[model samples]
Target chain A: MIEITEVKQYPFIEGKNLTLCAPNKDNLNLYASWDNHPDARKYARNVFPTTAGDLKKYLERGQERAPREIGFEIWHKADCKPIGFIGFNFVNWADRMGNIGLNIGDPSYWKKDLGMEATYLILEYAFNELNLFKITADMYEMNTPSWKICEKVGMKRELTYMKQAYVKGNYVDTYQYCLFKEDWEKQRQKFEFK
Target chain B: MSEEKEEKKELVCIPFIEGENVALAPTNIDHIQLYAKWNNDPRARHYARNMIPHTTEDLKKWFEPRGGLTEHVGFEIWHKKDKVPIGTCGFGRINWIDRNANIYMNIGEPEYWNKNLGTEASHLLIDYGFKELNFFKIYAGVFEPNIRSWSVAEKDGFILEGIEEKAIYVDGKYVGARRYRLFKEDWLNRKAKK
Candidate 1:
């Protein structure tokens, strides 16, 4: 069994103007609010509207898991406001791999390259602290904007299955992308973390 | 303005077979070392279908047959402005069956990996494939781990065919392979779209 722990405190991972940190109950409302956004629901697995109570229960369950996947709330370090969430899920220790998912729930932050910065920080934690060998991510083929983030951050598209999953009564293809530890190291060197 | 005009020269149409910026010409004995370095690079090897390290002798033997092909061709990918050979891109494994061939390239110099040189060279090669070689289709195989290659293929308008599982073994693991093809008809369509 893989032991999971909350990163209770973290130094601000500054990249451009964005910072990332572990989510607390105070930010649970932000998660709830983002969960209710229509655009967020379009690609999210659990599309149903979420409340603060639901988020609390979700985080609690996450904490109870053997291989605890942590979610971190993204912030603008300069302004100290919640922007979105970025973290790992479905972590498998034996394989030393995990799924990385992120969303900039705030439209104000979209297309500002904040997603790339937030992802770079989370990947640093996954590769450096967690010692994960590979990290995988997925997005619907039509979600070009999200996949562009994958491209900008050096994640490679590994697979695209036709009619792989049914979403909202329509069968849609999802592009599976991945970044290995070595590749991540190369990207780390290129990422401007200031 | 007159001073700037004095520095400019007419662009020369160099032979496609003479690769520009590369260190060793395609048929040179030293090319074995070049191939070894490219295959050993984690990023390059990832898309190379998990190629194992090749001894100098192994590389020599591999190139022996390829170098003998009447159409055995290679070109150095140069920095357009500086004209430094950062990589090599060209055809290998020319098969007459179905009138197709494999396209290969290596930006052994890591600094140029994300730059658009590979794409530009590939476009030039595809044009050569159609107008010069008179080929019906051109194909290439990339490992599932190499996402940059897929993006390049997509940008080049190559159609994804299918996956070949456990097709390659390297570093004690079986890596899956992806096949992509660009047909003459599709190429024409793409050209029209452009």
Candidate 2:
């Protein structure tokens, strides 16, 4: 339901000491390699390696899906390299809600608060640009670092299921977290990007 | 004897108990006013079974054995900013056989509703249930009219298990009750992906 052609490039979002921007064609290789990272794959729905050609095809398909799903590779404006990917997928226009999934592909970017900054950038896109009312996300319970990012961005944990998913021949529990547009608006008012 | 002591020390170091920013301690008679406020809320009354007006005796009866096997353990949700109690959250109808439990939460002060306090408190309680109490699943039975609560549950990762037909009698009318649940394993899986 999203008008993909209408999707404009998101300018840099200034944080306390960082800026998040949309990745360009030049960084596609970096984005693909980040996606293929085993550590990043651990929490991702897709586990297979992503080739540059695959990345191009994927983005082409994304454009066809239009406003319903959008992907953006996150980059620090200062460095200009892709650090992660953040996006809204399975957007339901009728309900004004969407499933949000993101990953900080580069381990070097971990724990530096870049994830939080990227999250805020995407949230702005979801609520301000896309007019979404609710955004939901799921994470493995043991992935404390990612959950910490969720927490920092004000996503609230709503439920936890035990051993509900079988991954890599082992069962694990999943946690669902969400943030409402209103809540984000309120938080944005008080949030210091720094 | 020395070997046994070493085993005990190792177990203690395992960090079986998980703590959260929101602490849910056992309630006392001193919390009577807080309980009364929650019980009087129209929305709370709409979901709760009709009972006699809350009295001092009722408070004592409720406070007694909150930590007991059969009774509900109530906790006053406190503000992390000032440590001032503002709401209530806890578990009831603990089913050991099914390894499940019922959860309820209320921010008596309307101002705090949707302010992330409930979500934070709920997350803390959920971690307690999954990590400390070892509950396999956590569930909530909510009135159909409470869309906000439903959103909260959905955000927390609770899946809609079922809807009971006219399961609750509130304000002289029969109301439908929607059940939401989160399994421990599923929660872990979702968390791991994040």
Candidate 3:
């Protein structure tokens, strides 16, 4: 077993209830356990079982990142635990645009508005710190929590692709949501970030 | 279209997958003015989501090469007989992991409207996507009133999948947007028969 207290803490973006920190590589087993759960894995498109070795490889690949894709663990301030994760993917620094993927692994933490908090925290980091112009999100049609979180974060429905992804032995539509820096500036207040 | 620029365009040595009347040419950054004209034209932009005027700098950033899953690429539709650039057609936002992409195209000059250039360009793009890119499915979005767009998609063997109501704010009011898809199996079948 990996040492928990020995794991280095990299606190980066902090929100009212959630803190976005660097992904802890030492906790690959913990992350894999969450990912292997069917409820959470469904939205993430994990048809195959995810092992800790796979996660270790993923962390190794992410370690060579040029800020193109950044992953973060969502630390709940009240619980003082990493209940979920969020990240930027396929980021084009020149274009100042990217797509984001996020998940709250613990089902017990569902519908708590912590995902919304994490989103605002990440948006601030993406638009203001990274100087990105836009951030997009994609979710299968049946994953209401994901697209709903996108809507709650003031993201506009960019496109609805018909039968774009296969999930649970069925073809499903995919929903794309986009939030521009300018639009975020205007709608940021709605998120009620304090 | 200046005399010097026209001469340059004529002498330009951008190779293409040549067709009978139209060739899919590279989108050279030097011809930003040509692309900007198409992007800014109300007739063309009417059906597109591009609301802002495009500049050379934006085009340069857009032409930057991107790899992996979420890349956007466009091809210039070069009219061989007229020896002029007619339009642009190519993949918009691509989900490479899912093996699907959005096929977007437009004929720049209004004069080329009824010449079947759009249909020809669509066919070329669809073929390139299925054969070259190995995409499993390709799709296009058409506004509610744009029957011409839907017809072109049909001619290229696309089927209407679904429609999103009030999906777009076109001229004044919100409008429904139609979605169309062409599967690789169907495309390959057509090619084999031909």
Candidate 4:
């Protein structure tokens, strides 16, 4: 006799080919690997390697939500693996606002619309489920893909922290973008993707 | 007996600098509610980066024991005519190393806005920054959406430094930020000319 069991796919919030779920212990190695990758590190602010021990601590931090913070793992529906990360490191529940941070660990997933889709999914979750008022994302000026993805997903540029970040070798400016729930609602309608 | 107590309350609200309509006073614990109320007001909070909703308790953490937490001392603005607190303004912080600081201001009462109180208070703060604290450089980062704010900074002789593109999120939009700086030498020269 043969037994058959269906494979389970976990997705807290569903997007087309992307699903956002909580970071899992099983994917700790992937997080560490991505944070340490040379190509990935160039875009990411993490100068130090995310070792297994450090990642375990980081995973634990995700569990503690307070005045407001949420973490997510970007799961590729087709590949069934978390190819990226996204989170609100600064969440003001009372103010209905948060500052979002994201990174795609797998370089191959870059420019595949995965980041854009994940952002749309999170924006929906942030405003509808969480009842947030506004969401913001800030990136180094050199991180063109980041700001572009944010702009494509309805975030409008709002602020420039001049020479704020020390990146690679010299000081670089950081661009900040944001969208309100109502604005996102209007903008999301204009974006239809496969 | 009640009248005497009321008089004492009025006495405590006295201003440090008596402007034409508004006067500046060192912020006191009793003024926490006023600060919290204004900060909670979306219109004023939007420009000041007071995104998080502030409760009286939160205000206490910031305004109370104002002596210890930081060098970012605040002042209460009292409307001379109404004898009521109109807003708060002061140095955001002092960089002892750099001999400079950022200017802070907020007109909680929407009615009080554009009444030239900001300009008057800015003049006062700039005087304090240059003459009192001996700061070499006093600067402010005005959000691009806030034209009136930058205009006042300009009127006070704060030169346009450099713009950081997309620096802050407010009113459902990402707004660029302009840095304005005023050197003590310029202020001294202007004073000498006068």
Model 2 root mean square deviation, Cα atoms: 20.7
> What is the C-alpha interface RMSD of model 4?
6.6
Indicate which candidate wins on TM-score: 3
User: What DockQ does model 3 achieve?
Assistant: 0.13
**Cα distance off (Å), candidate 4, residue A55:** 7.5
In model 3, the clashing pairs are: none
lDDT for residue A82 in candidate 3, whole number 0-100: 80
Cα lDDT tens digits, model 1, A1-194, are 11114333344555668777667675666677787878765676654568889889876774554465768778777655777888886786645678888988877778888887888888888899889888888888887888998898888887775544456777576787888888888657887776
Per-residue lDDT for B1-194 in model 3, tens only? 69876656553527477887888888877677778888889898878777777877777887665665447877888888877787888898787667788898888888989878888888878888998899989988898888888899988889887675455566766577788999999988987888
Interface RMSD of each: 11.4, 10.5, 6.7, 6.6
Q: Residue B8: error of model 2 in Å?
A: 74
Q: Summarize candidate 2's per-residue lDDT along A1-194 as a digit string, tens digits.
A: 11123222355555554555555555556677777778777777554578878877766663553478777767565654556778876786655677787888888778887777777777887899888777777787777887888888888876666554446766677787778788898878655665
Candidate 1 ranges beyond 4 A from true positions: A1-14, A62-68, B1-194
lDDT tens digits by residue: candidate 1, B93-150 = 5644335678877776788878776777788788888878877777778877777877
Interface DockQ per candidate = 0.01, 0.02, 0.13, 0.10
List per-prediction Cα lDDT, in the order shown: 0.70, 0.69, 0.80, 0.77
Candidate 4 docking class: incorrect
